[model samples]
Target: MAKDDLVSIDGKVSSLSGGGVYYITLENGVDISAKLCGKMKKFKIKVVVGDRVTVGMSPYDPTHGLILHRHKF
Candidate 1:
């Protein structure tokens, strides 16, 4: 699917796991696994528990997504 076809959602980092995977809790209370995007990895962005982040995922699969951006506030 094209980038535009992906849905972006706001969530908070709930836990860290091996292989750079993270569990994020969405606004509706569901948790999904995500991985840092290349831009964030290249910039060395760190995401810890309780940090708000923006996730991009396909509408068909909400269980996994890419960590697109980190919220400053």
Candidate 2:
């Protein structure tokens, strides 16, 4: 999909679910279900609860997204 088609949001991981899924709470107070993207898995990046991350969401389905990047600081 084109980058323009996805909306990026900054959020903190709230919890983990079955099958390596994560629940993220967005800055604007929305909670979305997220999963690590392919690149993160390929690079062996680890994501845990309470971590800040960037998620790419689709407007049509704002309740779920792909965790595209993690913020370490």
TM-score of each prediction: 0.92, 0.93
Give the TM-score comparing model 1 with the true structure, all chains together.
Answer: 0.92
Give the local distance difference test score of model 1.
0.92
Question: Cα lDDT of model 2 overall?
Answer: 0.93
Candidate 1: Cα lDDT at 50: 94
lDDT of 2 by residue, 1-73 (tens): 7756889999999999999899999999988899998889999999988999999999888998999999988
List the lowest-lDDT window of 10 residues for candidate 2. Answer: 1-10
Off by over 4 Å in 2: none
Query: Where does candidate 1 stray beyond 4 Å?
Result: none
Clash count, predicted structure 2: 0
Model 2 Cα shift for residue 69 (angstroms): 0.5
The all-Cα superposition gives candidate 1 an RMSD in Å to the true structure of 1.0
Residue pairs clashing in model 1 are none
lDDT of 2 at 59: 85
